[model samples]
Target: MQGTSYYIPAAAMAAALAFKVPSLVRAWRDPLLRAVCALLAMAGLVFFFAAPPTIAKVNRLTGVTNFSAPLVYALLSGFSASCLVLLVNWRGGPAERTRRISRRWIAGYGVHIVLLVVLFALGDTPVERLRDLDTYYANTPYIREMIVLYLTGVTVAGMTMNFLCWRWALQVHGWLRTGLLIIMLGYTFNTAYGAAKFAAVFARWAGKDWDALSTDLAPILASLGAQISAVGFCLPLVCQRLADTWHIWASYRQLGPLWRELDKIAPAHVRAVGNLWWSSAELSLTRRESDIHDGLLSLHPYFDHDVHARALAAAVAAGTDPEQAQAMADAAMVVSAVRARVADPEGKLLKSSDTAESATAEGTRDLVRISAVLREAPVAAAASGHAAMPESEVH
Candidate 1:
């Protein structure tokens, strides 16, 4: 059961690669995550092909062995490094030393890995006496000693990563954030076991009492740890998928009301972007009365009178870059203390989109929707709870 538990995180990690990769790429856009996965892939190749001989050698004795031992350590190392990067990025001003933080992280993990290798070479292996696991340990005393050390590292990094995730969850308000934090918590708890197992090994080295931390005590602890980790690993991806489904469902649910509301005066607001879709990939929404409700929410960002006017004015200004046009209006409104349309780093109005092209499109579409709402005086009046006079009646 304990052995099985260790694989839980491995499986969860695998599932995330399979299911959450696309979303992760889309949402987080963290290069470190991609690098981590790539490193895992490379390490797997080495483990199966090159490291077998080293593993065999270590298997022969119960003391120590191999540069390959860093594989598990690598998980924590990458995590620790990534967390530090995020922290640095979060705290650093525009003038802060960006390269310095990165260099420090690399140098730190590298030193740790080197010391571990040297320590592995010089440990007292009990290969002959350590049969079964005892036999494996017998050939490489260094391996035995390092096991506890490596696990401790895992624990330290895991704790740090999980805490970082928890804090991040606090910043973002949504189900996705909650799900990810839960997963992080789970992994942290499980990693503690892996860490403890390593600690136990170290204790044995300090004193020759191996039986004190046996399959009985260790396995149960390991098993419980695995359970937490396994759930943590798998759940974020699962919940993310589930959350997406619910989001789409909720969007569609609001479609009927949106359609009824927009249908009142002009389909101009509805048909402003005649060619563009709400979602070009999954749900193609082109019609005023079709699957377009999902796209309409972008207009919500500019529902207020001043926001609606500025956004529409931005659209009418006729610039080569629609994003720049939105930014122009967004800036004007910000100074006037008008609340609407979030600006991106470039001082352009933007949305959180997967693609650069889409980000601009979202910005343009937002203002367009606002354009729809305020094209005529009656429409603006309706939005503000005034008795809306029909365009023909006014004429």
Candidate 2:
């Protein structure tokens, strides 16, 4: 159980580090990313040192019985310091203020770390007690002080994180708010873990047997808290990336009918990109929009002003607002232009001056609105029918 608990947090930290590395590589100057990465790395180290098998191996390799205790304590203190700094960096303010705040935290935690080392040195625990180190040394001289100091530091950091996360959660929205809430909940577990350890240690001092709280229960809470907090840190970034991909895919799919109709008239305008289905939706949308513009340009000669005038009258009669009616009319004109081009590919080309201003203006409007019209408007169906006709009968 101990090994499994230790490994779980170790794995969570490793995953967090993996998730942050690419961003760190791209922008090493980003202080928040650096702080987060450092926090995860230190956390992984703490769990690695705390695991029983690894602790035993360190003791054997160093030839100092129970030497891993001080090492693990130091690493835990470092992890606490890193975590506190990360929260500070996350809740950013003015540059100088953030820096000053970070420095103050570092200095304060530095004192706790120094005290941890000093108290560990003053303690005399020659027996190896890896799994039950806290309970075993609960009544020992300076070992008790070291344990209390470490727990105090951890408890303070955890409570501070909980307060910051909860306060921030209430002010934010969407995934960020949810992530902060989860982080707040994780820190609640962390504070409870600290309380459990303090209780068991105090029980020992009082000559009672509440060793299970420290030996078993606290570790479980710590492991759960670590894993949950790691996930909370990552959730917003992951959700944002997923949302962007979904938007891109939706745009690509929604723009398909218009793009396909335009492609038929001006295949030459299509970029020579391969396997468009597998290409990025953003890139495909860009290329598709470009192709539609080029297709409209090619059909400029076939742009009949009468077709646009008739479509506008039909749309207004159908009760669409003027702005939307204009879009539908423009859509109908494009359909007529496509049919004219198919019917008479080599006929006399219409002069650019003869085209309605709306036909040219359509190129500059939002493609989404145009796509919506193409997919949903009544004139769009009429346009599609004309576009689908056999080339010989298109006229």
Candidate 3:
């Protein structure tokens, strides 16, 4: 149960890294992207190495008693540094200042990791304590110092992250603020993990046994915090891409009516832009709009000014808004034009005096409105019925 807690978050962090690597490679110079990938990688390593099964495996593979101790400590220090550096990049400032601050944190944590390894080498711990290593080695020589260093580093980083995110969250709005609030909550759990471990170690120093706090409680807290923090880091970036894809797909769907209406009159020579199966939503939407416009141009020769004038006056008299009235008028003209072109098939409509001066719909939005009225408006339906009457019967 305890080991499962660590492994779950480890797997989640690995998945987050997989999702981000392509973006990192594409924008190699983006400091913020680099920081995010670094944080995710370091976080995964910390969780994987901190698991008890992994700790025992490392000890066996290296043939050194408790060798996993210094390794896990160094990984924790690295992860702590990564979290702080990522926060620094996320809250941007002047380029030089940001870089300088990031470098300082990296160097400081680099030295701290080295000292942890050196102190572990100097100490003697023949007993392999996987879960309760902090409490177990609390009184050991240099091992004690190594444990203190890692715990302090993680605590300070968690507190600092919570402080920055809370302050920034209060000033921002929308998705960014939501992400920050989640991040702050995650780090609060992390800070509590550090406190739990420290309490267990202190109890050991006072001749008492509270090993469950360090062994059982701390891992649970750390796992929850790490997983929540990963979500907070990813939410804003993922949400934006999702919103863009949704908008593009909706625009494409909304244009379907107009595109189909235009498809009936499209000239065989126009060679419509084809959207391949694997094409992106944005590309497909653009192609559909282009095809609609082409069809509108081909239908222009059949437009009747008399049909447009009557539809426009009737729509206005019916209290339609100006924009919608214009759209209805254009749609009625299209309906009459399509029928005339079908009836005359030999270009007779092009030679008529009733052909409109300006007949084609102009913009994508206007085309959409015209397409909508074709299916719903009474004026367009009336025009369709009137155009179906024979020319000799009208006289």
TM-score, candidate number 3 = 0.79
lDDT of 2 by residue, 89-147 (tens): 88888988888888888888788888877887788988998788888899888888988
Alpha-carbon RMSD, candidate 2: 4.0
Candidate 3 minimal-lDDT segment of 10 residues: 386-395
lDDT of 2: 0.78
Tens-digit lDDT track for model 3 on 289-312? 888766666667766667777778
lDDT of 1 by residue, 1-395 (tens): 33234444445446545664675667674544544454334323322322234345554463333334444345445554554554445333453375576567767766766666666667654332221242245235566555555555556656665776677777765554755566576555546556445545555556655543533354455445434543543455567787777766554443433343444322455546543434532253224334233333332332333543555464455442565444334323222221222222221332432232321223433433334344434434433332222223211
lDDT (C-alpha) at residue 323 in model 2: 81
Q: Model 1 — TM-score against the truth?
A: 0.47
Candidate 2: segments with Cα more than 4 A from true spot: 91-93, 268-275, 296-310, 343-359, 382-395
lDDT of each: 0.45, 0.78, 0.82
Compute each candidate's TM-score over C-alphas.
Answer: 0.47, 0.84, 0.79
Of 2 and 3, the candidate ranking higher by TM-score: 2
Error of 3 at 351 (Å): 13
Best candidate (score: lDDT): 3
